[model samples]
Target: MKIVEIGTGYTQIPAKIGAATEIVIENLLNGLNNNGIEHTLIDISYSNQVKNSDKFELSLTHYVNVPNWLNKIKDNGIIHIIRRIWYSIGVGLLLRKLYRNKLQTETYIHFHNQFNFFFAYLIAGRRLRKGKIRTIYTVHSPDWSNSKKIPKKLFFEKIAILKADVIISLTNIIKDRIKESVKINSCKIIVINNGVDLNKYHPIIQGDKQKQIINIGSVCKRKNQLETIVNIKEFLLKENYKFVFAGKIIDHKYFNEIVSYIHSQSLSEHVKYIGEVKPGSELNKLYNKSMLYISHSKQEALSLVVLECMAANTPVVLSENFETFVDFDSKIRNAVKIISNHNLINEINNLCNNVSYHKQYALKQMEVIQEFYTWDNIAKLMIKKLAQFKQTL
Candidate 1:
């Protein structure tokens, strides 16, 4: 069998897309032990210099013409070229022609974002009904499917995705959300937890570890970095623990609120914003130097940062209510400390009181991840399902 993955959105180049694409290809690479199977990745980038593995290939779309192209009007400026007439007419025609050319091949696109999913559906609708090829649509989030303002888009989105043979859900919560919106039942949606390379993120030398705790991810309202900073504020006054807010700042208003709280709490020296750092090197160092990794986000779907910390064998303190810890309830009860208020310092103080014992929970969680989250296992499960699909077809 051959597989094709596509991600066309601009944000598809960011961390989340990077993670999904890495898992897809890495798993396929792991699956290469079977000499009979073939795989290909198609996107806007692989049009040239495609992969050479006879069984695996990368197919790229035509390059975007910058400046003059209407589709690229927002390449830098603040306009939706896709809405413009001239560029849309020209570039849109070229795109339709390109998809028409490629429909001859057997491919299943793992569209990393919603926009591409809808586009793929429209561009390939005729071929899809004729069974010219297969398509696998993974819902990363319910952005387009569940938004109030996107009702028109939602109809096509539902039609396109429900048409798929399979839908991979990163968590059961997301699976339930999809089930509510689409008529497809559980069998059509499979739960495949994302994986981490346990070997790479292993905990490093326990440094003298002055007071440092690291929180990864962009600073945003959804991220709830404010709560973490509040926790740091509380920790600073009670204990000497240092807090490092890594990653770039976003959501300026919320970020400013956090800064104000930090100032009011007099934690300027204790809590440091290290900006963005290299994930492989600098970020790992931050994780290694810290005693615990904390996240205060209210919304999550199997957090990658938490899993990464578990792989590193560092304790994680995530702000989760009763519902958020559905999967790891035991660890949630044992490892997580419920933040009752914005008294983040008090929360961290309460948590740090027994970091070592809580460390066991992270280790146990890591064990669970190693058992179930590895792409090798995920690929095996996916391949088995696909084989069954092929037999049925």
Candidate 2:
């Protein structure tokens, strides 16, 4: 079967920086290519730097150009809505021409963004019937899964769900939440976890690791980096541990709060916030050299970094709030430490003080990554599920 994968249109595919959704799309396409699956990626035009980069293969990619003036507006405001609508219309028109006389059942159109899917449905949904071309929507971030109120985004997400033939959720918890929130049939949703590139992120032999802790994500209130520092204040002050935070500063105010807290507590020497780091080699190196990787994110569908760390044979500690997000089984539970805000310091200490225990957790994490979280394995699972889904159609 042929497949057409659509990106968020806000970021280029084969992302060089910190757009997790775009990165996931890039890896999934690579997985498909490795399996010899016929597919094409439809994404926004790349920047001059990305165009010059030798890292990505653009022969199979179709670039959609949005107006340059739109970039000047603030993100997630009027510009966000306008660009999504523009991209969706472009995608719909392009698909119409591509599939003019082609057999619809032989093709699949997969989408990863709510706004794009919602608007594209308006243009393409009526023309493509249920038994014809299949539309699959993968919910990358179910931000409204736990919300009590119906925000504007949730409304669009609900519409997208109704428009899609099938929905792919990153975790069982998220699948259940989507069912309850949207009142859709559970059979329509498939659970597939995000994947890591094992070839790029693998364990390295080292004599001894220094006392370093690393957290990678956008510096924002949602990621809760400041709270992570607050929880480990004593360690930063008394111990020789260095806390390294890396990501684009999406929220300058929240970053300032982290800086002020670090300064107020005399932690300039112990803590550092290096801005966004490129993915692949740079990220994998950071994961390998650090003694431990930690995240205090308030919400996530499934963190790609968590899997990357595991593939690098690094022990991971997470906030207890992610218990639902990761949806770890008993086997996977032994691979990572999850602690509440109250027990954060104690758990970190337990992992840091015992070298054997740290090694054990790292080994277990690598085992889990090998068994289930590789990109090739995930791509095969998606193909299997799609075959089954076709039988029903």
Candidate 3:
């Protein structure tokens, strides 16, 4: 069977921008290829004209044209919504052409975004009854599971959930949220956690490690980087270790606020800012060299970086607000230090100062990840689920 994976086709399938969803897609396709699946990914290219080709070795990359004018608009809540709807329609047209060709093999159209699901329902819902194609959507973000977005978008998103043949939830939190909000039957929703590329991120031996702590994600309010910065200052002052904040400055005002606080507190010498390191040797090195990895995000669906750090055998610290770690096995959960925001500084210092505890902490976290969260295992689970779906057909 052939699979047509739907996503936002950037200029490249493995985009240099290192968006988490794109990285997950790239790895998921690699996993699928290793399992001997034939698939093609069709995505919206923001360029004015269509530039489609077989670019990626693992899966064919088909770039559908989206108006270049849309790319020029500065990102806002409205523009992002418009972009999603635009890509959804483009995907719908592409599928229509494919259907008209009277394709020979059974096809599975897997959607990564909720907006695409909306257009797919409008375009492919009829074709679904013809039995040539099956549709599935993986809800990768928490926003879809909750009715918290703009009402119009939420309406489309809910309809999309209702229309899909299968729904993949990245976390049980999402699955439960969907069951609660959309009232979808438990049988249709599958809880599959995101997996790490074990080959790229396994533990690495370093000659000399620094007393460095690293946080990787967008510099936005939701990420709560500023709060982490302010709270960690006393720990830095006492330990004289450096903290690296590496990610795009997504929210200018919030970023400026972080910078201002850094200067005002005279912590510039202790803190370093490396803007947006793409996933590669540099990022892996950062994960390897750091003594600890931390995230103070107010909420998350799941964090790929934290898993990458665990794979690198780095001790991790996360705020209590994160729901992802709560889903971890008890032993795995104990390996990570999840503290309330008020106690962050003390917890960080305690972990940093105790060398033996830190070493054991890293080892346990790595062990859990290796045993349970490899991309190969994740792909196998997906294949198993697909096999069951085929039997029903």
Each candidate structure's TM-score, on Cα atoms with residue i matched to residue i, is 0.74, 0.92, 0.88
| lDDT by candidate, in order shown | 0.56, 0.80, 0.76
Query: On a 0 to 100 scale, what is the lDDT of residue 135 in model 2?
Result: 85
Off by over 4 Å in 3: 9-11, 46-55, 68-83, 101-106, 144-153, 324-326, 341-343, 389-393
Estimate the lDDT of model 1.
0.56
Lowest summed lDDT across 10 adjacent residues in model 3 is found at: 144-153
Worst 10 residues of 1 by lDDT: 9-18
Clashes of each: 8, 0, 0
Q: Cα miss at 173, model 3 (Å)?
A: 1.5
**lDDT, residue 210, candidate 2:** 69
RMSD of each: 5.5, 2.4, 3.0
Clashing pairs in 3: none
Please, what are the lDDT tens digits per residue for candidate 2 over residues 223-321? Answer: 889878888879867778999999988788989889999899899989999888899888888888888888888888788888899999789999887
Best by lDDT: 2
Q: Write the per-residue lDDT of candidate 1 for residues 257-278, one digit (tens) a residue.
A: 8788878878888888777765
Deviation of model 3 at 135, angstroms: 1.0
Model 2 Cα displacement at 29 (Å)?
1.2
